[model samples]
Target: MTCALIYRGNDILLCRDENDKLSFPVVDINNYDNSEIIYFETDGTQYAVLPEKTAETIAGGVWRGLRESWGELEPKTWNIAAKGAELAHFMQTNRFCGTCGTALVKASDISRRCPACKREFFPSLSPAIIVLVTRGEEALLVHAKSFRRPFYALVAGFVETGETIEECVAREIYEETSLRVTDIRYFGSQSWPFPSQLMLGFTARYASGRLRWADGELSDGGFFTRESHPLLPSLPSISRRLIDAWLNGEIGGK
Candidate 1:
Protein backbone atom coordinates (compact mmCIF):
# COMPACT_ATOMS: atom_id res chain seq x y z
CA MET A 1 0.00 0.00 0.00
CA THR A 2 2.96 2.29 0.68
CA CYS A 3 6.00 2.96 -1.49
CA ALA A 4 8.90 5.38 -1.55
CA LEU A 5 10.61 7.29 -4.35
CA ILE A 6 14.16 8.04 -3.32
CA TYR A 7 15.97 10.68 -5.34
CA ARG A 8 19.59 11.85 -5.33
CA GLY A 9 20.03 14.98 -7.41
CA ASN A 10 18.73 14.39 -10.94
CA ASP A 11 19.01 10.62 -10.54
CA ILE A 12 16.70 8.11 -8.83
CA LEU A 13 17.48 5.07 -6.75
CA LEU A 14 16.62 1.74 -8.37
CA CYS A 15 17.23 -1.29 -6.22
CA ARG A 16 18.46 -4.58 -7.69
CA ASP A 17 17.29 -7.46 -5.60
CA GLU A 18 18.81 -10.93 -5.19
CA ASN A 19 16.57 -12.21 -7.98
CA ASP A 20 18.17 -9.56 -10.25
CA LYS A 21 14.78 -7.93 -10.88
CA LEU A 22 15.03 -4.16 -10.70
CA SER A 23 12.50 -2.32 -8.52
CA PHE A 24 12.10 0.86 -6.54
CA PRO A 25 13.06 0.64 -2.87
CA VAL A 26 9.48 0.99 -1.68
CA VAL A 27 8.74 0.66 2.01
CA ASP A 28 5.72 0.88 4.25
CA ILE A 29 5.32 4.37 5.66
CA ASN A 30 4.08 3.16 9.00
CA ASN A 31 7.05 0.81 9.47
CA TYR A 32 9.53 3.62 8.94
CA ASP A 33 8.85 6.65 11.11
CA ASN A 34 10.38 9.78 9.66
CA SER A 35 9.22 13.21 10.79
CA GLU A 36 10.71 15.03 7.78
CA ILE A 37 8.72 13.07 5.20
CA ILE A 38 5.87 14.24 2.98
CA TYR A 39 3.55 11.59 1.58
CA PHE A 40 1.26 11.74 -1.43
CA GLU A 41 -1.24 9.33 -2.88
CA THR A 42 -1.93 8.45 -6.53
CA ASP A 43 -4.49 5.87 -7.62
CA GLY A 44 -5.24 4.82 -4.03
CA THR A 45 -1.58 3.95 -3.40
CA GLN A 46 0.39 5.99 -0.89
CA TYR A 47 3.99 7.08 -1.56
CA ALA A 48 6.60 9.07 0.24
CA VAL A 49 9.78 10.86 -0.81
CA LEU A 50 13.03 10.14 0.98
CA PRO A 51 15.50 12.76 2.02
CA GLU A 52 18.81 13.07 0.17
CA LYS A 53 20.88 11.41 2.91
CA THR A 54 18.37 8.65 3.43
CA ALA A 55 18.11 7.98 -0.29
CA GLU A 56 21.89 7.75 -0.67
CA THR A 57 22.12 5.35 2.22
CA ILE A 58 19.43 3.12 0.79
CA ALA A 59 20.35 3.28 -2.90
CA GLY A 60 22.87 0.65 -4.01
CA GLY A 61 23.13 2.17 -7.46
CA VAL A 62 21.49 5.25 -8.96
CA TRP A 63 20.02 5.59 -12.43
CA ARG A 64 21.31 8.84 -13.93
CA GLY A 65 17.97 9.82 -15.47
CA LEU A 66 14.57 8.25 -16.07
CA ARG A 67 15.12 8.33 -19.84
CA GLU A 68 18.11 6.01 -19.53
CA SER A 69 16.14 3.17 -17.92
CA TRP A 70 12.69 4.07 -19.19
CA GLY A 71 12.22 0.80 -21.00
CA GLU A 72 12.97 -1.23 -17.91
CA LEU A 73 10.40 0.59 -15.76
CA GLU A 74 6.71 -0.08 -16.18
CA PRO A 75 4.51 2.74 -17.46
CA LYS A 76 2.49 2.93 -14.23
CA THR A 77 5.62 2.87 -12.11
CA TRP A 78 7.22 5.57 -14.25
CA ASN A 79 4.19 7.84 -13.99
CA ILE A 80 3.77 7.50 -10.23
CA ALA A 81 7.49 7.69 -9.53
CA ALA A 82 7.84 10.83 -11.63
CA LYS A 83 4.86 12.37 -9.83
CA GLY A 84 6.46 11.52 -6.51
CA ALA A 85 9.66 13.22 -7.59
CA GLU A 86 7.75 16.29 -8.70
CA LEU A 87 5.93 16.50 -5.37
CA ALA A 88 9.20 16.12 -3.50
CA HIS A 89 10.81 18.90 -5.54
CA PHE A 90 7.82 21.15 -4.96
CA MET A 91 7.91 20.59 -1.20
CA GLN A 92 11.65 21.22 -1.02
CA THR A 93 11.49 24.49 -2.94
CA ASN A 94 8.39 25.86 -1.21
CA ARG A 95 9.57 25.46 2.35
CA PHE A 96 8.43 28.94 3.26
CA CYS A 97 5.59 31.18 2.20
CA GLY A 98 6.49 33.56 -0.61
CA THR A 99 3.99 36.23 0.40
CA CYS A 100 4.50 36.35 4.18
CA GLY A 101 7.90 34.62 4.59
CA THR A 102 6.33 32.25 7.11
CA ALA A 103 6.91 28.51 7.37
CA LEU A 104 4.28 26.65 5.36
CA VAL A 105 2.41 23.51 6.34
CA LYS A 106 0.88 20.73 4.35
CA ALA A 107 -2.51 21.92 3.20
CA SER A 108 -3.64 18.72 1.55
CA ASP A 109 -2.26 15.67 -0.16
CA ILE A 110 -0.98 17.87 -2.98
CA SER A 111 -0.89 21.41 -1.67
CA ARG A 112 0.85 23.61 0.91
CA ARG A 113 -0.69 26.33 3.00
CA CYS A 114 0.76 29.43 4.67
CA PRO A 115 -0.68 29.88 8.14
CA ALA A 116 0.15 33.55 8.38
CA CYS A 117 -1.09 34.68 4.98
CA LYS A 118 -3.59 31.84 4.39
CA ARG A 119 -2.03 31.34 0.96
CA GLU A 120 -2.10 27.95 -0.70
CA PHE A 121 0.33 26.60 -3.28
CA PHE A 122 0.12 23.52 -5.39
CA PRO A 123 2.41 21.68 -7.79
CA SER A 124 3.02 23.69 -10.97
CA LEU A 125 2.66 22.19 -14.40
CA SER A 126 3.40 23.98 -17.65
CA PRO A 127 1.57 23.13 -20.87
CA ALA A 128 3.38 22.98 -24.19
CA ILE A 129 2.26 22.18 -27.74
CA ILE A 130 4.16 19.89 -30.13
CA VAL A 131 3.00 19.54 -33.70
CA LEU A 132 3.99 17.34 -36.63
CA VAL A 133 3.68 19.47 -39.75
CA THR A 134 3.16 17.48 -42.87
CA ARG A 135 3.33 18.49 -46.53
CA GLY A 136 2.03 15.87 -48.94
CA GLU A 137 4.33 12.92 -48.25
CA GLU A 138 6.84 14.77 -46.08
CA ALA A 139 6.86 15.94 -42.46
CA LEU A 140 8.65 18.99 -41.14
CA LEU A 141 11.23 18.30 -38.40
CA VAL A 142 13.31 20.86 -36.58
CA HIS A 143 16.49 21.08 -34.54
CA ALA A 144 16.15 23.42 -31.59
CA LYS A 145 18.91 25.51 -30.02
CA SER A 146 18.31 23.85 -26.64
CA PHE A 147 18.69 20.22 -27.71
CA ARG A 148 21.75 18.54 -26.22
CA ARG A 149 22.01 16.17 -29.18
CA PRO A 150 21.89 16.55 -32.95
CA PHE A 151 18.65 14.71 -33.65
CA TYR A 152 15.58 16.59 -34.93
CA ALA A 153 12.09 16.71 -33.44
CA LEU A 154 8.63 18.13 -34.11
CA VAL A 155 8.11 21.87 -33.66
CA ALA A 156 7.25 22.64 -30.00
CA GLY A 157 6.86 25.65 -27.77
CA PHE A 158 5.23 26.62 -24.50
CA VAL A 159 1.64 27.83 -24.66
CA GLU A 160 1.53 31.50 -23.93
CA THR A 161 -1.19 33.17 -21.84
CA GLY A 162 -4.37 34.17 -23.68
CA GLU A 163 -3.69 31.67 -26.49
CA THR A 164 -5.71 28.62 -27.51
CA ILE A 165 -3.99 25.26 -28.06
CA GLU A 166 -4.55 25.51 -31.80
CA GLU A 167 -3.21 29.04 -31.92
CA CYS A 168 -0.16 27.97 -29.93
CA VAL A 169 0.45 25.13 -32.35
CA ALA A 170 0.21 27.35 -35.41
CA ARG A 171 2.37 30.04 -33.84
CA GLU A 172 5.03 27.59 -32.65
CA ILE A 173 5.33 25.96 -36.06
CA TYR A 174 5.61 29.34 -37.74
CA GLU A 175 7.98 30.78 -35.14
CA GLU A 176 10.32 27.83 -35.21
CA THR A 177 10.26 26.84 -38.89
CA SER A 178 8.88 29.86 -40.77
CA LEU A 179 6.09 27.71 -42.19
CA ARG A 180 2.30 28.07 -42.09
CA VAL A 181 0.12 25.08 -41.46
CA THR A 182 -3.62 24.26 -41.65
CA ASP A 183 -5.98 21.38 -40.96
CA ILE A 184 -4.67 21.17 -37.43
CA ARG A 185 -6.07 18.06 -35.78
CA TYR A 186 -5.53 16.83 -32.25
CA PHE A 187 -3.42 13.72 -32.28
CA GLY A 188 -2.56 12.68 -28.71
CA SER A 189 -1.04 13.89 -25.48
CA GLN A 190 1.50 12.81 -22.88
CA SER A 191 2.56 13.86 -19.41
CA TRP A 192 6.25 14.74 -19.76
CA PRO A 193 7.34 15.15 -16.12
CA PHE A 194 10.99 15.96 -16.64
CA PRO A 195 10.03 19.00 -14.61
CA SER A 196 6.28 18.79 -15.01
CA GLN A 197 5.14 19.40 -18.61
CA LEU A 198 1.92 18.33 -20.31
CA MET A 199 2.67 17.92 -24.02
CA LEU A 200 -0.28 18.36 -26.37
CA GLY A 201 0.32 16.72 -29.74
CA PHE A 202 -1.24 17.74 -33.05
CA THR A 203 -1.01 17.06 -36.78
CA ALA A 204 -1.15 19.98 -39.18
CA ARG A 205 -0.85 20.11 -42.94
CA TYR A 206 1.65 22.52 -44.43
CA ALA A 207 -0.34 25.55 -45.61
CA SER A 208 2.41 27.71 -47.13
CA GLY A 209 5.90 29.17 -46.83
CA ARG A 210 9.34 27.61 -47.23
CA LEU A 211 11.37 25.79 -44.58
CA ARG A 212 13.47 28.31 -42.67
CA TRP A 213 14.82 28.38 -39.11
CA ALA A 214 13.62 31.11 -36.72
CA ASP A 215 17.19 32.41 -36.42
CA GLY A 216 17.57 32.31 -32.62
CA GLU A 217 15.37 29.48 -31.34
CA LEU A 218 15.77 27.01 -34.19
CA SER A 219 19.08 25.90 -35.62
CA ASP A 220 17.82 24.06 -38.67
CA GLY A 221 14.70 22.43 -40.08
CA GLY A 222 13.42 20.81 -43.25
CA PHE A 223 10.72 18.62 -44.69
CA PHE A 224 11.78 15.04 -45.25
CA THR A 225 10.00 12.14 -46.82
CA ARG A 226 9.88 8.80 -45.09
CA GLU A 227 12.56 7.47 -47.43
CA SER A 228 14.95 10.34 -46.64
CA HIS A 229 14.13 11.14 -43.05
CA PRO A 230 17.00 12.22 -40.82
CA LEU A 231 17.75 11.13 -37.25
CA LEU A 232 14.80 11.65 -34.91
CA PRO A 233 14.02 11.79 -31.24
CA SER A 234 13.99 8.54 -29.31
CA LEU A 235 10.88 6.59 -28.31
CA PRO A 236 8.93 7.15 -25.03
CA SER A 237 8.07 10.70 -26.10
CA ILE A 238 4.92 12.08 -27.68
CA SER A 239 7.03 13.82 -30.29
CA ARG A 240 8.48 10.48 -31.30
CA ARG A 241 5.00 8.99 -31.38
CA LEU A 242 3.79 11.74 -33.70
CA ILE A 243 6.84 11.29 -35.90
CA ASP A 244 6.42 7.53 -35.98
CA ALA A 245 2.74 7.85 -36.80
CA TRP A 246 3.57 10.06 -39.75
CA LEU A 247 6.33 7.76 -40.94
CA ASN A 248 4.04 4.76 -40.68
CA GLY A 249 1.48 6.62 -42.80
CA GLU A 250 -0.90 6.96 -39.88
CA ILE A 251 -1.21 10.75 -40.06
CA GLY A 252 -1.33 11.70 -43.76
CA GLY A 253 -3.82 9.92 -45.97
CA LYS A 254 -1.49 7.67 -47.96
Candidate 2:
Protein backbone atom coordinates (compact mmCIF):
# COMPACT_ATOMS: atom_id res chain seq x y z
CA MET A 1 0.00 0.00 0.00
CA THR A 2 2.94 2.37 0.51
CA CYS A 3 3.30 2.18 -3.32
CA ALA A 4 6.88 0.71 -3.31
CA LEU A 5 6.70 -2.95 -2.27
CA ILE A 6 3.93 -3.98 -4.66
CA TYR A 7 4.78 -4.88 -8.29
CA ARG A 8 3.04 -5.33 -11.68
CA GLY A 9 0.56 -2.50 -11.06
CA ASN A 10 -1.97 -5.29 -10.88
CA ASP A 11 -4.57 -3.60 -8.67
CA ILE A 12 -2.66 -4.35 -5.38
CA LEU A 13 0.84 -5.03 -6.74
CA LEU A 14 2.00 -5.98 -2.97
CA CYS A 15 1.31 -6.75 1.63
CA ARG A 16 1.94 -5.71 5.41
CA ASP A 17 0.74 -6.93 8.83
CA GLU A 18 -1.55 -4.78 11.00
CA ASN A 19 -2.42 -6.99 13.92
CA ASP A 20 -3.51 -5.35 17.20
CA LYS A 21 -4.33 -8.24 19.51
CA LEU A 22 -1.66 -9.50 21.89
CA SER A 23 -3.25 -12.95 21.61
CA PHE A 24 -2.35 -13.01 17.93
CA PRO A 25 0.62 -15.26 17.16
CA VAL A 26 4.11 -13.73 17.08
CA VAL A 27 6.70 -14.34 14.34
CA ASP A 28 10.20 -15.09 15.60
CA ILE A 29 12.61 -13.84 12.92
CA ASN A 30 15.66 -14.18 15.19
CA ASN A 31 17.17 -16.62 12.70
CA TYR A 32 16.75 -14.06 9.89
CA ASP A 33 18.93 -11.44 11.59
CA ASN A 34 16.19 -10.76 14.15
CA SER A 35 14.00 -9.07 11.56
CA GLU A 36 10.84 -7.45 12.99
CA ILE A 37 8.63 -9.79 10.94
CA ILE A 38 6.03 -11.64 13.01
CA TYR A 39 4.74 -15.11 12.16
CA PHE A 40 1.47 -16.92 12.88
CA GLU A 41 -0.02 -20.29 11.91
CA THR A 42 -3.16 -20.09 9.74
CA ASP A 43 -5.41 -23.12 9.33
CA GLY A 44 -7.45 -21.33 6.64
CA THR A 45 -10.01 -20.79 9.41
CA GLN A 46 -9.21 -17.09 9.86
CA TYR A 47 -8.42 -14.39 7.31
CA ALA A 48 -9.09 -16.83 4.39
CA VAL A 49 -5.33 -17.53 4.47
CA LEU A 50 -2.91 -20.43 4.40
CA PRO A 51 -1.49 -22.48 7.34
CA GLU A 52 -0.23 -19.26 9.03
CA LYS A 53 -0.17 -15.47 8.84
CA THR A 54 3.47 -14.88 9.91
CA ALA A 55 5.40 -14.07 6.73
CA GLU A 56 2.49 -11.94 5.53
CA THR A 57 2.07 -10.09 8.82
CA ILE A 58 5.66 -8.95 9.12
CA ALA A 59 5.45 -7.47 5.66
CA GLY A 60 2.13 -5.75 6.43
CA GLY A 61 4.03 -2.51 6.83
CA VAL A 62 4.17 -2.34 3.05
CA TRP A 63 0.65 -0.89 3.08
CA ARG A 64 1.20 1.66 5.85
CA GLY A 65 1.34 5.39 4.93
CA LEU A 66 -0.06 4.48 1.51
CA ARG A 67 -3.60 4.72 2.79
CA GLU A 68 -4.83 8.21 3.56
CA SER A 69 -5.76 6.95 7.05
CA TRP A 70 -5.76 3.61 8.88
CA GLY A 71 -9.47 3.88 9.75
CA GLU A 72 -10.34 3.31 6.11
CA LEU A 73 -9.41 -0.38 6.09
CA GLU A 74 -11.55 -1.00 3.04
CA PRO A 75 -11.33 -3.98 0.68
CA LYS A 76 -10.28 -1.80 -2.28
CA THR A 77 -6.96 -1.38 -0.49
CA TRP A 78 -4.42 -4.24 -0.30
CA ASN A 79 -2.28 -5.13 2.73
CA ILE A 80 0.99 -7.07 3.08
CA ALA A 81 -0.55 -9.99 4.99
CA ALA A 82 -3.12 -10.45 2.23
CA LYS A 83 -0.53 -10.22 -0.52
CA GLY A 84 1.73 -12.83 1.10
CA ALA A 85 -1.18 -15.14 1.82
CA GLU A 86 -2.32 -14.88 -1.80
CA LEU A 87 1.19 -15.64 -3.08
CA ALA A 88 1.54 -18.62 -0.76
CA HIS A 89 -1.82 -20.00 -1.85
CA PHE A 90 -0.97 -19.42 -5.49
CA MET A 91 2.32 -21.29 -5.08
CA GLN A 92 0.83 -24.09 -2.99
CA THR A 93 -1.86 -24.88 -5.54
CA ASN A 94 0.50 -24.62 -8.49
CA ARG A 95 2.29 -27.59 -6.90
CA PHE A 96 0.07 -29.79 -9.03
CA CYS A 97 -0.76 -29.50 -12.72
CA GLY A 98 -4.08 -30.26 -14.43
CA THR A 99 -2.50 -31.38 -17.70
CA CYS A 100 -0.21 -33.83 -15.95
CA GLY A 101 0.03 -35.38 -12.46
CA THR A 102 3.71 -34.48 -12.14
CA ALA A 103 4.96 -32.20 -9.34
CA LEU A 104 5.72 -28.53 -9.97
CA VAL A 105 8.16 -26.01 -8.52
CA LYS A 106 9.08 -22.34 -8.83
CA ALA A 107 11.13 -21.45 -11.86
CA SER A 108 14.29 -19.30 -11.74
CA ASP A 109 12.19 -16.45 -10.45
CA ILE A 110 8.43 -15.74 -10.84
CA SER A 111 7.43 -18.47 -13.27
CA ARG A 112 6.33 -21.88 -11.96
CA ARG A 113 7.75 -24.83 -13.90
CA CYS A 114 6.25 -28.28 -13.91
CA PRO A 115 8.88 -31.01 -13.67
CA ALA A 116 6.82 -33.54 -15.61
CA CYS A 117 5.33 -31.57 -18.51
CA LYS A 118 7.65 -28.57 -18.67
CA ARG A 119 4.64 -26.27 -18.38
CA GLU A 120 4.99 -22.87 -16.75
CA PHE A 121 2.43 -21.55 -14.24
CA PHE A 122 1.77 -18.04 -13.08
CA PRO A 123 -0.55 -16.51 -10.46
CA SER A 124 -4.26 -16.47 -11.32
CA LEU A 125 -6.99 -13.95 -10.66
CA SER A 126 -10.77 -14.15 -11.14
CA PRO A 127 -12.42 -11.18 -12.78
CA ALA A 128 -15.76 -9.90 -11.40
CA ILE A 129 -17.87 -7.17 -12.97
CA ILE A 130 -19.86 -4.82 -10.70
CA VAL A 131 -22.36 -2.54 -12.41
CA LEU A 132 -24.94 -0.01 -11.28
CA VAL A 133 -28.13 0.06 -13.38
CA THR A 134 -30.12 3.22 -12.98
CA ARG A 135 -33.28 4.93 -14.30
CA GLY A 136 -33.52 8.64 -13.66
CA GLU A 137 -32.75 9.09 -9.93
CA GLU A 138 -33.48 5.47 -9.01
CA ALA A 139 -30.90 2.68 -9.14
CA LEU A 140 -31.29 -1.11 -9.19
CA LEU A 141 -30.02 -3.30 -6.35
CA VAL A 142 -30.39 -7.01 -5.81
CA HIS A 143 -30.22 -9.14 -2.66
CA ALA A 144 -28.09 -12.24 -2.87
CA LYS A 145 -29.97 -15.49 -2.31
CA SER A 146 -27.46 -16.35 0.44
CA PHE A 147 -27.63 -13.03 2.31
CA ARG A 148 -31.19 -12.03 1.56
CA ARG A 149 -31.99 -11.63 5.25
CA PRO A 150 -29.07 -9.33 6.02
CA PHE A 151 -27.59 -7.76 2.90
CA TYR A 152 -28.55 -6.31 -0.49
CA ALA A 153 -26.15 -4.84 -3.06
CA LEU A 154 -26.11 -3.78 -6.70
CA VAL A 155 -26.13 -6.05 -9.76
CA ALA A 156 -22.78 -7.81 -10.23
CA GLY A 157 -21.33 -10.99 -11.70
CA PHE A 158 -18.17 -12.73 -12.91
CA VAL A 159 -16.84 -12.52 -16.46
CA GLU A 160 -17.65 -15.29 -18.92
CA THR A 161 -15.52 -16.43 -21.85
CA GLY A 162 -15.46 -14.61 -25.22
CA GLU A 163 -17.15 -11.47 -23.94
CA THR A 164 -15.71 -8.05 -23.20
CA ILE A 165 -16.20 -6.59 -19.70
CA GLU A 166 -18.89 -4.22 -20.98
CA GLU A 167 -20.51 -7.04 -22.94
CA CYS A 168 -20.39 -9.23 -19.86
CA VAL A 169 -22.07 -6.47 -17.87
CA ALA A 170 -24.97 -6.25 -20.31
CA ARG A 171 -25.37 -10.01 -20.60
CA GLU A 172 -25.23 -10.53 -16.84
CA ILE A 173 -27.91 -7.92 -16.26
CA TYR A 174 -30.09 -9.47 -18.90
CA GLU A 175 -29.63 -12.95 -17.47
CA GLU A 176 -30.18 -11.86 -13.86
CA THR A 177 -33.10 -9.66 -14.75
CA SER A 178 -34.86 -9.66 -18.12
CA LEU A 179 -33.87 -6.03 -18.68
CA ARG A 180 -31.92 -3.92 -21.17
CA VAL A 181 -29.13 -1.45 -20.38
CA THR A 182 -27.32 1.41 -22.10
CA ASP A 183 -24.77 4.16 -21.61
CA ILE A 184 -22.42 1.80 -19.76
CA ARG A 185 -19.83 3.93 -17.95
CA TYR A 186 -16.58 2.88 -16.34
CA PHE A 187 -16.48 3.94 -12.70
CA GLY A 188 -13.64 2.19 -10.87
CA SER A 189 -12.31 -1.15 -9.70
CA GLN A 190 -11.79 -2.93 -6.37
CA SER A 191 -9.82 -5.89 -5.08
CA TRP A 192 -12.31 -8.40 -3.55
CA PRO A 193 -9.81 -10.97 -2.23
CA PHE A 194 -12.20 -13.11 -0.22
CA PRO A 195 -10.07 -15.65 -2.03
CA SER A 196 -8.70 -13.42 -4.82
CA GLN A 197 -11.15 -11.76 -7.21
CA LEU A 198 -10.41 -8.58 -9.21
CA MET A 199 -13.70 -6.64 -9.41
CA LEU A 200 -14.32 -4.09 -12.17
CA GLY A 201 -17.04 -1.56 -11.26
CA PHE A 202 -19.21 0.36 -13.70
CA THR A 203 -22.35 2.55 -13.85
CA ALA A 204 -25.08 2.13 -16.45
CA ARG A 205 -28.38 3.72 -17.47
CA TYR A 206 -31.54 1.63 -17.59
CA ALA A 207 -32.84 1.12 -21.12
CA SER A 208 -35.95 -1.02 -20.54
CA GLY A 209 -37.64 -4.02 -18.95
CA ARG A 210 -39.73 -4.77 -15.86
CA LEU A 211 -38.55 -6.06 -12.47
CA ARG A 212 -37.33 -9.65 -12.77
CA TRP A 213 -34.99 -11.89 -10.76
CA ALA A 214 -32.38 -14.33 -11.86
CA ASP A 215 -33.23 -17.94 -11.09
CA GLY A 216 -31.75 -19.26 -7.83
CA GLU A 217 -29.06 -16.56 -7.50
CA LEU A 218 -30.90 -13.44 -6.36
CA SER A 219 -33.88 -13.62 -4.04
CA ASP A 220 -35.06 -10.02 -4.53
CA GLY A 221 -34.67 -7.22 -7.08
CA GLY A 222 -35.91 -3.64 -7.21
CA PHE A 223 -35.14 0.04 -7.78
CA PHE A 224 -34.25 2.15 -4.74
CA THR A 225 -34.02 5.88 -4.15
CA ARG A 226 -31.48 6.47 -1.44
CA GLU A 227 -33.48 9.29 0.11
CA SER A 228 -36.77 7.41 0.34
CA HIS A 229 -35.83 3.78 0.73
CA PRO A 230 -36.66 1.37 3.54
CA LEU A 231 -34.13 0.56 6.24
CA LEU A 232 -31.62 -1.28 4.03
CA PRO A 233 -28.72 -3.40 5.08
CA SER A 234 -25.54 -1.73 6.24
CA LEU A 235 -22.83 -0.94 3.69
CA PRO A 236 -20.14 -3.65 3.97
CA SER A 237 -18.40 -3.86 0.63
CA ILE A 238 -16.02 -2.03 -1.70
CA SER A 239 -18.37 -3.17 -4.48
CA ARG A 240 -20.98 -0.88 -2.96
CA ARG A 241 -18.83 2.16 -3.67
CA LEU A 242 -20.49 2.72 -7.07
CA ILE A 243 -24.00 2.91 -5.62
CA ASP A 244 -22.65 5.15 -2.88
CA ALA A 245 -21.09 7.47 -5.43
CA TRP A 246 -24.31 7.61 -7.44
CA LEU A 247 -26.45 8.04 -4.31
CA ASN A 248 -24.52 10.92 -2.77
CA GLY A 249 -23.54 12.18 -6.19
CA GLU A 250 -19.85 12.37 -7.16
CA ILE A 251 -18.88 14.11 -3.87
CA GLY A 252 -20.51 11.37 -1.70
CA GLY A 253 -21.20 11.55 2.03
CA LYS A 254 -18.37 11.85 4.52
lDDT score for residue 162 of model 2? 86
Q: How close is candidate 1 to the true structure, as a TM-score?
A: 0.92
Error of 2 at 193 (Å): 1.5
Clashes of 2: 16
For candidate 2, write residues 1-254 as lDDT tens digits.
Answer: 11222222222222323554111123333333212222223343222222323334444333222222223444323344455445655655676776897787667333478888888887688888988888888878788777635556777888987889999999889888888999998888765544567889888888998877755677787887778654444544455577667678662222
* Per-candidate alpha-carbon RMSD to the true structure: 1.9, 8.7
C-alpha local distance difference test of each model: 0.81, 0.59
Instruction: Provide the TM-score for each candidate, comma-separated.
Output: 0.92, 0.70
Q: Number of clashes in every candidate structure?
A: 0, 16
TM-score of 2: 0.70
Residue 229 of model 2, lDDT score:
53
What's the true lDDT of residue 139 in model 1? 86
